[model samples]
Target: MAENKTLKVPGATLYYQVRGSGPVLLMIPGGPTDAAIFAGVVPHLTDRYTVVAYDPRGNSRSVLDGPAEDVHADVHGDDAHRLLAELGDEPAYVFGSSGGAVIGLNLAARYPGQVRTLVAHEPPCGRILPDAEEYLAGTEEVYQAYRTGGVEAGMKRFEEFVGLSGEEQEQPQTPPSPEMMEGWGRIGGNLDFFLGHVLRPVSGHLPDVAALRQGPARIVVGVGDASTDRQYAYRSAVALAEALGRPPAVFPGDHGGFVARAEEFAVTLDKVLNAT
Candidate 1:
């Protein structure tokens, strides 16, 4: 059974879900996605681990105390720390995808003792890549599209920039419930937050190489085997691994592979986590 709960952090009210029973495995989502994105994979790991997923501040069920503003990676990391502390679990295993992976990097760098191992999948740390300027400009272009046209416009540009098409582009997404409509105000409100506050900060933010190198937690950067080399995330993951002095662990599919191949992804994740 899954239990939904909320926690009051310094600047936001975070909503989270907990399921199963065993060692804690916290999953952090990326893009504009919330905790619910991990629903498909939860069942596979429930028997062996207590899976925790939550809405990052200002996204979905998690709301900030004040008006939404540009957020830094460390602030998101701090929120992750608070959530982990609230769970009463220290040294928990963490899996962060996309922007969430950026947050995990900050968490491991700043609060190493709180995480046992951090598997950061395709973090869009654009600054670390060789073509950093170009990628960062692309993110700005995406934001500009959002400002002028709307979420769909921005998403279209984003999809083009990321090279998403065919099955990856056509994959079905779960629609929001009627109840969720109330809190969010409008359908594209979260997209506004992602473009105005999240995209640039996360994608452009540089990870603290020194802090990570000296940190206690084991860090493994991940890239999807099927992710094209042209994709920013795949390149970013490769760059991040180089920065960390380690190789990027290849997973089953592209950026959203965990969603497309949940069962296989879970098995791969289990193997990654258990490896010595």
Candidate 2:
């Protein structure tokens, strides 16, 4: 059973859930989605880790204290640091996806003392790419697409940005479970906040690689096996891995692997976290 809780942060009230019992493993979900996104993976990890999943301030149940505004990766990073401090006395393991991964890197760079290991899965850190200017422009386009259109139109543009329809190494996809479908619908509903305010600032972050390399937290950059090199996220993740001087640990599916292939992703995640 997961215990629901909330915490008062600098500018928002964050909603979080805690389950299992052992070492702390904080799960930070990407933008547009909240802690509910981890429902499938949580069941598998409870035996070894106390899983803490949350809605990053403004998404889902985490209500913003003021009107909607642009939130930088470091702001979200600070939120993670506060969450960690409130949850446990010791440094905790962290797993962040997409925008959340960007936040993880910021957290590790600025507050490594609060994190033991940070598994950053497919962070859209375009600044590290060789053709970063081009990539950043495309990222801006993605934000603008959402600004002009909506999630439906924006997602189509995002899919194109990630080459989901263009040149992807299309792996056959199993129909997402009903739970996942429901989760997707909810995410779709809240995506305005993500595409509207969260996307640009988070994606635009230029990671402090020197700080991360020198920091105590072990940084594990992750990419999805189902994603190809041509994709924006795949390319950026690879670039980030190179910047970090470590090969990306491959996950099971594409960007949504943790949700689509939860059991396998969980097993792989456990292995990666335990490996020397």
Candidate 3:
């Protein structure tokens, strides 16, 4: 059974779900993609671990107390720390995808002892790449499109920017729920928060290499096997891993691999988690 709960942080009321048993494993979703995004992969991990997923502040059920402002990577990282502390789980295992991966990197660097192991999948750390200015400009362009036209137009540009145009985009294996549909309906607001607050901060975030290198937690950078080399996310993962003096661990499918290939992704995650 899954238990839905909320925690009051400094400026937001975070909504989180807990399920299964054993060691605690916290899963963090990408930009504005609330806890529901991990529904497919959570079930597989639940059998062996207590899976905890949450909606970040200003996204979905996790509402911010004040006006939505531009947020930094450390702010989100602090939220993750508060959530873990509220869950009464010290040094928990963490799996973070896309934007969430950047948060995990921040957490590992800033609050090292709070995380046992952090698996960061395809973090779009554009600043770490060679053509960083180009990538950053593209991200800004997507945000501008969102501001001018709307989510559809923005997403279209985003897809093309990430090399997901045409046949590259994968079909959903499972249908979305009513709750998810409602969330999608309100995605415009989330998109605004993402574009205004998250995009630049996360993409430009330079993880504290020295801090992370000296931190206690084990850090593992992940990249999707099917993710094209053209995508900055794939390249960023490789760059991040190299910075950490570790190789990027390859997983199944592309950016949304956890949902697109849940079974295989889970198995690979289990191995990575359990490996010495």
* Position 221, candidate 3: lDDT: 95
Residues 70-145 of candidate 1 have per-residue lDDT tens digits of 8889889999998899887569999999999999999989889999889999998888887788888898999999
| Worst 10-residue lDDT window, candidate 2 | 167-176
> Native-vs-model 1 lDDT?
0.84
Q: Where is model 1 more than 4 Å wrong at Cα?
A: 165-189
lDDT of 2 by residue, 1-276 (tens): 789999999999999999999999999998789888888888889999999999898887899999999999889998998999998789888999988899889999999899888999998888888788987787788888877887777777877876676653433235555645666677866778888888889889999999999999899999998887777778888988888899999999888787778889999999888777
**TM-scores of the models, in the given order?**
0.91, 0.93, 0.93
**Clash tally, candidates in order:** 0, 0, 0
lDDT of each: 0.84, 0.86, 0.86
- At residue 19, give the lDDT of candidate 2: 95
State the lDDT at 238 in candidate 1: 92
**Candidate 3 on 167-204: residue-level lDDT in tens?**
36554567755655665665666877887777777877
Better of 1 and 2 by TM-score: 2
- Distance from true location, Cα of 7 in model 2, Å: 0.8
Steric clash pairs (candidate 2) = none
* Alpha carbon deviation, residue 136, candidate 3 (Å): 2.0
